[model samples]
Target chain A: MTAAALPRTTVDRRPPLGGFSLTYLALEIRRVLRNRRSLFFILIMPAVFFLLFGLPQKGQNIDQANSAAAIAYIMISLAVYGAMTASTATGGAVAVERAQGWSRQLRLTPLRPPAYVATKVLSALSLSLLSVLVEFVVGSIGGVRMPAHVWLLAGLGAWLGSLVFAALGLFVGYLAPAENVMQFMGPILALLALFGGLFVPLEVLPHVMRTIAKFTPVYGVGSIARSPLTHDFSWVAVLNVVGWTAFFGLGAALLFRRDTARV
Target chain B: MRTDTLAASETTGTRTPAVLLRGLTKKFGAVTAVNQLDLRIEPGEVVAFLGPNGAGKTTTIDMMLGLARPTQGSVEVYGLAPTEAINQGRIAAVMQTGGLLKDVSVAEIVRMTASFFANTRPVDEVLERAGIADIADRRVAKCSGGQQQRLRFALALLPDPDLMVLDEPTTGMDVEGRRDFWNAIRTDAQAGRTVLFATHYLEEADAYADRIVLIRKGQVVADGTASEVKALAAGRQVRATLPGADEVRLAALPGVDRAEVRGETVLLHTNDSDGVARYLLTQTTARDLEITSRNLEDAFLALTSGEDTDLEGVSR
Candidate 1:
């Protein structure tokens, strides 16, 4: 009965959008990084790859291609790997939330849907950066060199790669069946990376594989990422990455809206 | 089952409640989950929504929280829409699934969830209230089911919401854990916060709820307190231990609805237990006679028939 006398806590409806994105980003980072498995997958795997692959690519069959090409492609491949893994994890996380009714929980709370989505985007983007940096340092320590401006291409490639792959993951997270999320992602991403010129140069792949690689998202991301590695700019590769990002970005959002409509 | 007995002042004459609903409905594909649901939850009262599986409890909670757009109705929490109410952090929920991220310490999830609100409760105070102080540093994935449930309770409490909603919150708990969970619920209710509880556990509602609303086939079937519901159970049962030669005699009771003989004992069922008991004692050598009043389950069964069709189909 004394509850009537207790000061009530009213919800603040008009909070400015200040740092809301940061709050979400911070939360996602904390949650994802806290997972030992996620940490290994996100941080350690890329660094290991950089040490393993970044250093050895130069020792492998030598190419007249710019040392920047090798370093850039390594960065691009690592970035794609990072984005793909993060998206897969994030998509799986979203699927789990859907199954467990967590989204419904947020829907009932004061957290906006856009805020939630924005947080996922920022987290994946950041993780991609972290993974890229770790790989970059490993490659540099192993004696790979890039001019300062050449570094910008690596950054752009990594960022665009994150957006494109992260958007694909967002779309899949909403659209995929709850039970099959884990089983489908690894093979699909591996195949894309293998054919789209992440593992082997597109020029070295069989003609059929090269044809199939053109439409895959990896081609877009890999082309831009590999630009510094090769002296030549691959606008088509950049366009492919941008196109896939936009395609999957819009598609995933639409699926999410459709999926949540049932809630 | 009739809700007319609720004092008009308590619901009708009262001001706008903390949570209000007018014919909310949610649908998936062709299947409609919630039907027409008109409810009012005032601050400081605990209201239990009782229903069986697939009765749309989750869907209704979703509409109130603004997770799902009502196909037909509107939900107002803290005088605003569900999503709007959440944005203000005026509302909180203990969802069916624990939203705490696996691999992180429980303390971290609490801190992040608390940051979402402007006037959050202190971290330790909230943690202690949820009985999760000892496990604050443990990774969330390592916690026991009871611990996870308690951790979620802590997260929900961090915001110190005006309107708190729970969806099947005790699904994976043991007896002692359930008691601890109810303790948290009672604490919130005692604080004068409005609580909307959706549970299948009859005892939880029977023991704690100020009012109970029963939904069957997506429609509100009965709305009242436990006593009010039990009062509607008009049927009664009679049992007697008659010494030998009882089968034929018991069948001849004056107002018996059903009669069955098992060895030396005869059992009779009648709406008029007093009349039947009197006859059994006087007309025959029936010893060890016993009579008990009808329980809520009797009333519940009488109220809801199996295979009942859908209820209100309003969209949010």
Candidate 2:
């Protein structure tokens, strides 16, 4: 065919930035929920942990001088853990999408890059919220005892603290290979949980370990989440969580910029 | 079904070209993928970008679609920037491979992509158009290569784009699949939408494209209608039984480009085979005469293999 045979076409302009359509969010949420393996890792496993550790025992301390009831403390910790797992898991999914060339596909569309990232984060937060809810339910069924105020504070703190992990997930998704993203994230989350006093109370740990735990990002999230249960708010923990959130958020943004600059 | 909408837009009577590249160049470190390419494609023209491996076809297409930033020069689609044109739903592309979520069902993928566009065809209609409605419920990972290609086509159709760019869209498909894919594209093209495709398939360029643009080593070597480009490299062969033929005299004939004596047969290569055949018939006792025109593959090799010829002046 020659160029002379066809009539020329003219440009027709349309509006850009169709302001956060609910359909995009709904579709993303559906995709995340459909992944059963992700659901298990982010929600069910944390619920199981709450059930195992929060059950009231015959001789166990129900309440201590500084801390709230043992069931309530364990419930908050498990819920925070679930939130972190869910957020990071979503980041890992982002890495897999990049590997699959889905980012390239997205670049060709009307959807902007920032909008894509926002959708992923929103869906991740939704899943993390579900994980936290499931853990609370399991804790309730296991005879957790706490005032209504304590329950609300702890739940809100844990859910909000997960933003740090969501940022971390985006960082690792851009940094790590797709197939090994979970492998890279799993041990880090577990170690963070151990050191941050989600698995074992900081008071019971040796003096040196407790000091190091205060420096970990999870330590801030753990301390803040458990403040309602422990009736003690550590300004140091708040500072730590805020600091790490900024660090990870900046790192993820930089990495995403670099990745998109290529291919 | 939405031809009326397309016709209404066309009658707006604006005269912007579908695509225009002026001195477009892209360099990756020391390697240049495309160099000083200038082209203009009018609307509703089905143009084939023909090239060999590493011939800069992909790079040129990448620049055209705004996937890569050019080191020098500019690209405009519908007189708008490439990215702006794409965001406004004026352009869409079907990539060669790996632009899909493997775990999702076909319908889910289509709907997901459709969510990004402000205006879209009905998902079921796109599915039927691409001929993948039967596999709408199946996971993309489970679909065959051809089925996946069709799914990509469905995604491209979501915005009812004015220009569709397909990069090696039929690379992995079998013969029947290639035919079906082109048939779908043809139906869309018949609606007066502009289409640009890059492929190494000679027959595809000859059969599907109204114009052929051949690029080699980061520069366009030839650009014209299929027959015109073919004529640039077209050499015909005339074989006749002329015992004791004077190979020197034959080579020096009016239209003959080369002459060879093969046993009892005298073979003459010429740009004008009919003239040479007439000479052999009327002026000589040439028996068992035959003439054959060179195919597009031969034209391609001839145009691409030589030391960089400045055919940019010849291409219009």
Candidate 3:
């Protein structure tokens, strides 16, 4: 029999970018949002850290004008930490998906690899935005006395900078075994945060550690987020973020291709 | 561009074969999984790929689905590359297991799959057709093996594909579940969809497939209608107790396919059981003669074990 009789439900195949649909993104985000336990920790921990470390000081001998500027600086650092955790956590769920054969199932579909990667990045970024917003709100309630524009710019900078971590998460998600990925990720991210000066001021760190902090992936994001309030912008920070983004993004793309090819 | 390719496939007003593989080979290190396999399946034909475990059925199916590249040769679906056919939504597959996410509801995953295609059947309609409508709200992890297989079926149907490739679609299902799943598949096949399913169950191939292709060592050993294939391996067995029966002499006898002499008991596989039995009873000191027809399972073993007569001409 000829295929002419088959009900031809054909449509123009979308281009790679066109394959990335809002419907898919919304569904993925909805699934990610269902893990409320992770969301609770990601959102609450930064605020709690801000209350403990940045809340106590009234008039400290810091480089900034007043305790309020120092508090805003600390709040942005913690927000960067929160955003990193949220985005990486979101992106790292790929390890479980891969382990479950969902990635292979997706390879059978019309969805192109580029579209899949795009959806993943956007989904992770969306969660990062949420984490940044939560920190900003907590900072607001805790009497962070920055100009409104600084709060907006700093929050946007932090959320956008977390793209580097999103790429890192995908790379690790594709590389690490699914069962112990999170266990390795938690300590690794905490160390990056500590060394990158998201927890303590870089000026207070020992000379050697301060030098090492500038080279960490978190340093560029933290520096950019705080630059709005402290006027500490530098081309080095931009180069660091771009360089790591390319490194991790290329690694993720390669690993994803390898993973799909074998399965 | 699209119509041009479609028209090209309609040579002499006959469409291209639904699936065609030529000299397809796949190797993993020192192991050869599929060895120069060639097959051509016409549209609307429900063909069962029959083989035992480790017979390279899954490897062939994987190459056909373009999930793995062939080490050599080509795979075409409706005259297009397998991956191209998939991109056009002409083909979809229900893999054996582990395709569904455990935490997602059945209906939700179905909708998500529907979003992957440019044009698709309604998600609810596909779910209903696959017979999983009642359990649409159930989480996949809570569903039984049969329910999850049905869910995979629902996902495959979303693209409204013209060809469905299933790899052991009913592997873990109960007998009744197998019956229901095949019933659904039969209905879909009756709608003029070309289907290629890999199964190790002889009864499943006999009962469901219009044609069966039996494979052994990654090569087609038998390809014919169920009855024809059965006829190829069709015969009777004759057994008799005799002192020092010569297996070579009995195997050379007229109509005997294979003969085995074990101590005093001699077993002979032959089409003319009466002739073999008579000779053993009358011409020798044989006693306690017995004859039995070969069942499909026996036929399966004979065909797959390379013990059957040369069938290269039978399938052609």
Candidate 4:
């Protein structure tokens, strides 16, 4: 066949910069929401943790504050933890897509690499927001109390803080084997949660552990999320978040560059 | 020879060919998957890339599609870099396997892909055109290999691409499935789409491609039309029944390359079966004579199997 024989119905009409298609995002969001396992991890698991740990101590006092304050503190921490997990898991789904050779398929399309990466980050953020919302609802029903300003600021902080873990998830997704990514990320995120004071207060830990926790990315998110109620905002925690976000963001970018260079 | 077809396509104004490869080479540590190869495929021509396993067909295709960077040399699609052509929706591909998400329904996959294209055919239209409309709701994992392939074709059609590259697109299909798949491809090609397909099936190339490019050990050993490639191998066979046939004398006959005896029949492999047939009829007491030209499979084996021959001379 010659060029003259080509069907006139199909012609070149490509737009400049095939980036962030709403339809594509909607489909991806639908796929993620329909995944029962992802839903359980992102929503149910954190709510369960909040109910088990925070409900019993609902009326107790901590740090010279009402028991409600203590419940609110735990609620915020678990919410941040859930957001972080959801974002990281969403990023890690890249491993499965890579294994399925979907990346190669995308290369053949009009979608640019940067656009693809942006879509993934946005999807992760969406899921992270849902995780935070689920924890917030559970906390509200369980009688956890906080000022309106604190709820707004802390929830926003927690959701924004998850960006670091989302970047880390992308890095790990590109670096690790597809089948073992979740297995590899689960324990690693769990350790970060513990050391970052999501499970227990950093003040209760030994001096060395507390010092080390200050450097972990999640410590910054936790501190920032709880600062409104605790009335303490550490510069070190803020710097930790910024520093680790850059670190993981660069790592993910480099890995993505390398991965695309490979056949 | 169908050289006129290749020439006719090349002379069509100032338009760039769909694909061009120059001194393309790919190496993996100590192993070289593709050597210094050059090829130009004009727009609207259907070319079949044929080779044995590990013959660098996939590697070459990868380089052309921008899935892999060449260790040396360069590739261009429609006068632009491959990635640029792809981003412009000038090119699209349907790979052999592993490109589909098995968990998603066929319609979902098509819709997702369509979203990436700036100008796509209607989703239902593409599905129906690819003959997968009935199976659109089926999960990709539940669909048969042929059905999954049709889905891939649907995805490729989303961009309304001018150049379509397929790497063994019908690898795991039944006979009916293969025929159905080719019919769709043929319809697309006849509409003037440029197609480059790599396949192990010689008959598919013979029946569909206007040009056949045979590669061996990372280099093109033969490039021509199907009949031209077939003629490169030992030409044909001349068989006849002659009681107590003398195999040695038969082998010495003009145009005969080798002679063998089976039961009451004498089989002669020849470069010119016409010469052998004429000689058999006039000089020998032969009965039930038959002359058959070699098929593409024979041509493929003959062109690729021999190790000592300098194939570079035959590559054009």
* C-alpha lDDT score of every prediction, in listed order: 0.71, 0.83, 0.83, 0.84
Candidate 3 colliding pairs: none
Docking class of 2: acceptable
Largest DockQ belongs to which candidate?
4
lDDT per residue for candidate 3 within B1-316, as digits (tens), equals 0112122234535657788899989898988889889887777778889999988999999988888899998999888887788888788899999878887899989988878877788998998999999999998999999989989999999878888999999998999999999999888888889898999889999899887888877877777767556655667778889998888999999989789989899999876788888898889999999987766676678778764355443333
Best by TM-score: 2
- Candidate 2 per-residue lDDT, tens place, B241-312, comes to 998888999999987868999988999988678899899999988999998778899889888886554343
Comparing 1 and 3 by DockQ, which wins?
A: 3
Q: In model 2, how large is the Cα lDDT of residue B29?
A: 92
Sort every candidate by TM-score, greatest first.
Answer: 2, 4, 3, 1
Q: What is the lDDT of residue A248 in candidate 1?
A: 88
Give chain A TM for each model in order.
0.86, 0.90, 0.89, 0.93
- Please give the lDDT score at residue B272 for candidate 2: 76
lDDT of 4 by residue, B19-63 (tens): 888888999998998988878788788999999889999999998
Residue A160 displacement (Å), model 4: 0.4
lDDT assessment of candidate 2: 0.83
Top-scoring candidate (lDDT):
4
RMSD of each candidate?
6.0, 5.0, 5.9, 3.6
Model 2, position B4, has a per-residue lDDT of: 23
Q: What is the TM-score of chain A in candidate 1?
A: 0.86
Write one digit per residue (lDDT tens) for candidate 1, span B1-316. Answer: 2446343235445556678788877778898788787776666667788888888887888778776678898889867877677777677888777565665688877776665565578889888999999989998879988889888888888767777788878887899989988897887678787787898887887887887777766667667766555443334678888867456566666656468888887778665678888887887788898986677666565555433431221010
Per-residue lDDT, model 1, residue B151, is 85
Residue A229, model 4: Cα distance from true site in angstroms = 0.8
